[model samples]
Target: MPAEQQHCSEKSAVTNSSTHLPVRAEWLATHSEMALDPALPVIDSHHHLYDRPGSRYLFDDLLCDIRDGHNVRATVIVQARSMLRADVPAHLQPLGETEFANGVAAMSASGIYGDARVCAGIVGFADLTLGDAIRPVLERHISLAGGPIDTGGRFRGVRQSLTWDADASLTNPLYPTTQSMMDEPLFRRGFAHLAPLGLSFEAWVFFHQLSRVAGLARAFPQTQIVLNHCGGVLGIAAYANRQAEVFTHWKLGLQELADCPNVMVKLSGLGMRLGGFAFSDRERAPSSDELADAWRPWIDTCIDTFGPDRCMYGSNFPVDKGSYGYGIGLNALKRLTAEYSRDDRANIFWRSAQTFYRLPESSMVMSSSNR
Candidate 1:
């Protein structure tokens, strides 16, 4: 194993010695509240499926959240290095994740997990440094995802995240700082292959790197780019006391990014540890109203810049579950966008993701329209 992966494995073993802390049913039950606008359709645009030593969130965990009274009809699975075949070559390891996700999709399709279609879209990782040679890897993923088959084919995009920082404490050591992965000639060459394959690109860079995303969008105007975690606004470590400065910088960068018509923003991940929400430190989890108040400025700025059509709400679950329950996390999104028109709300909750991922039209319909 690489030093980073080995280190992470060792750390996870240590952490698992205690207990997995997230998705605690008891803690979430304390904040029991009815689903906000239960009729609203939702397609959780970004989430993960991982079974680490300390934390294991897979099909059952996802089903628990989906059945929490919200109308989550489908979901998009983001890559998280789970279920990778250890026997495979380094480049081919990501296929195992897609295969794992496809199995989850198959399970959800059996109607055993209620109406929510988990892993309706699969966003796996590929080393874009391979440049054009990455095509074969992508084709392998598509073929394994069932190609054009209706029941299992849901390979949507690639998410080779560039979420690195020089401050070691602020970033994952596995993704060491690259300074400019997005601007690299080799990376661009690999990224250029997506549009032709009808695949989108999920950019998971931090706030300081938004300029690189902007440049990428401008360069690949035909390709669809989804900005993960609202440009991954960092509020931890060196950024902890610099909220004001970060906001100003993030806002300006967002405005520049929005100038690219093909790019969309995911309104989620605010509850993450790196986001600096501090909700988990409280005596009790925050209510929807409190979360809405805390997140309004950033969410409003995204909506104002990208409009409802380009802004979709993602749960970023299991990751966000570290701080808040799935119910509370999604309810916060509901509370945040309550002031928008019904159509706009629909766009954020589901339509934007549906269109962006090109998911099945039949599966995207709202279960109940009486709200």
Candidate 2:
């Protein structure tokens, strides 16, 4: 067996007992069956890596999930401020995240973790509010990501999250209470710098803010922008009891955003706390079928509007782990897309991510006919 497989088997006997704040291994173990269509290739378009006070999901944790029965051939590491360097200047702190992700990519490439190349694309954080000043930071990320010890050329994009709300409980304390980032002149100026450097922008905003992202996409048609978490649909706290009202507005916003061809949507994050699914509060985990049924409307809307080529599946893992296991999460996606044509399903699973991130063609698991 491969070294990674051997290691996984040894640890399989030992259940995770860590009392992490958001993700409990005991809870995830409540449902253990692998999903249907396990052979479908996936790129896991969005996930995070962190080692924090109440939570810690490192390389091993990620690999364990990848080995949990899906053909996850690659992954894109989204930023969560996990490993920023405290020694660096405030703005330069994000470079350390890229460096750390590239190191993880290097480890995955060693073949010890099977063929799935985790962090095949690294999307680190950068404050685009810096305007023109953000250029050097972008260069630094590019340089470090392409350095000798890093992944050869997997650094793809930057994500300056604008996920916020007026309700204090719903918003991340670290983020400013801004109404719209796209309207900021300084932010727009900084966003313009991305296209010239061949970097894509990963935009994370609430469903209400979809029009803002649509405006940004229209303003900078040259830049490729990815809409993270199905445009960050909220169903928690203030928005909890009004699911019907929220969905009506959310669908309208999504339709407007879909008019912008430069944008793509990541079809995941349905299990997030912000969505108010409350999957974590259940006595036992829901099955893949249950997950598929609940997420179908939103997922189908994105696929129908964006088309399969512009819609890709994402795990949003460790965060999504708060509600469901990695296998069940992905299995739910498989069940959701079961009716689509083979090519459409392939696009949702892996091809869209490969094209959007500009991941190397050699890393792709294309069929002999395509070759």
Candidate 3:
């Protein structure tokens, strides 16, 4: 069995709401390595900043990671039920997240945060199952994110999490989802609004569900879809002791999803307990090399199938923090792609995210050490 990993177990009295396996800061500190390429610019394509009942990872927590040593110049904040509005109608509540993220963007834009432009692009959440009623909600989100989409809105897109599974442990009951959630007519109708608004979509489905994502991509080729967490690899519960089977299914899914020209993938999240790394089982936090070795088979396959142009790196932080530190997590990514051409590496590092999210020009500045 994989190392018992915890995530957002809010129901657990001893643990925080935001952390699954509470990160052992002291254990992680036992081994550390500086950024592999300090000058190589990066845009952390996907990260969440949520303040749950027992957990809090706000702007300050993220800044600490940014200060850890990577040359991350900009970031795209993905939605995670963060800073939601309590006063608004149920459907209109997501707008508060956009407002919160954009406010953070404004703070980073002020230059006081130094080189990093936090939340340069924001991906807010809205239940697409709401169908056309979601249009007004999306408009309000766009408004909160700052401006018009074609003219470069900081609001990049929408992510209605589709992660689901038969095993109870593999899924999150907090967000009720189904195997056919993607195929629902009402969901499709709401999703249709994205392309017209010039907005992109982020899919956070599991490996077994990647084929469904492929179908959705083909159904809406005009809309840009970015697959999250390396297509949501599974390692616990029914997926345990079956790495070979899981990898085979995952590879086939990757190939099928890659056939959709409209879809892209993020090379992140393998550090999570769901990924079955079981690094947490060790007496100490795993080193970057260990992470790189365990992750290479998965991350390498993503780049191989999707190519650099359609691939970007995301920290998937705080969630994966249970397995490794921010710097170490990124170092594993850097080490995995150490042999790629500089331009290709840049795509995985920052360019692809900037392109996909329509991030600002400030994030495009490449440092002299970008070799």
Look at candidate 3 and give me any clashing residue pairs. Answer: 6-20, 6-21, 7-20
Tens-digit per-residue lDDT, 1-371, candidate 3: 00112222111112243315666665666666767898788899988887776667777778777676678889889988777789878777888889999999899888887878999899999899989999988888898887885665699899988988887666666677999999999999999999988889999999999999999999999999999999998888788899999999999999999999999999888867777778878898888999988988899999999999999989987777777778888898899999999899989998899889887676555555553
Query: Model 2: how large is the Cα RMSD against the reference?
Result: 3.8
Per-residue lDDT of 186 in model 3: 96
- Comparing candidate 1 with candidate 3, which one achieves the higher TM-score? 3
Whole-model Cα lDDT of every candidate shown, in order: 0.81, 0.82, 0.83
Best-to-worst order by TM-score is 3, 2, 1
- What TM value does model 2 have? 0.92
The residue pairs that clash in candidate 2, if any, are: none
Once superposed on the true structure, which residue ranges of model 2 sit more than 4 Å away at CA?
1-21, 147-152, 365-371
Better of 1 and 3 by lDDT: 3
The residue ranges of model 3 lying beyond 4 angstroms of the native Cα positions read 1-19, 150-152, 365-371
Error of 3 at 55 (Å): 1.1
TM-score of 1: 0.91
Q: For model 2, how does the per-residue alpha-carbon lDDT over 113-136 read when each residue is reduced to its tens digit? A: 778888989998889899999998
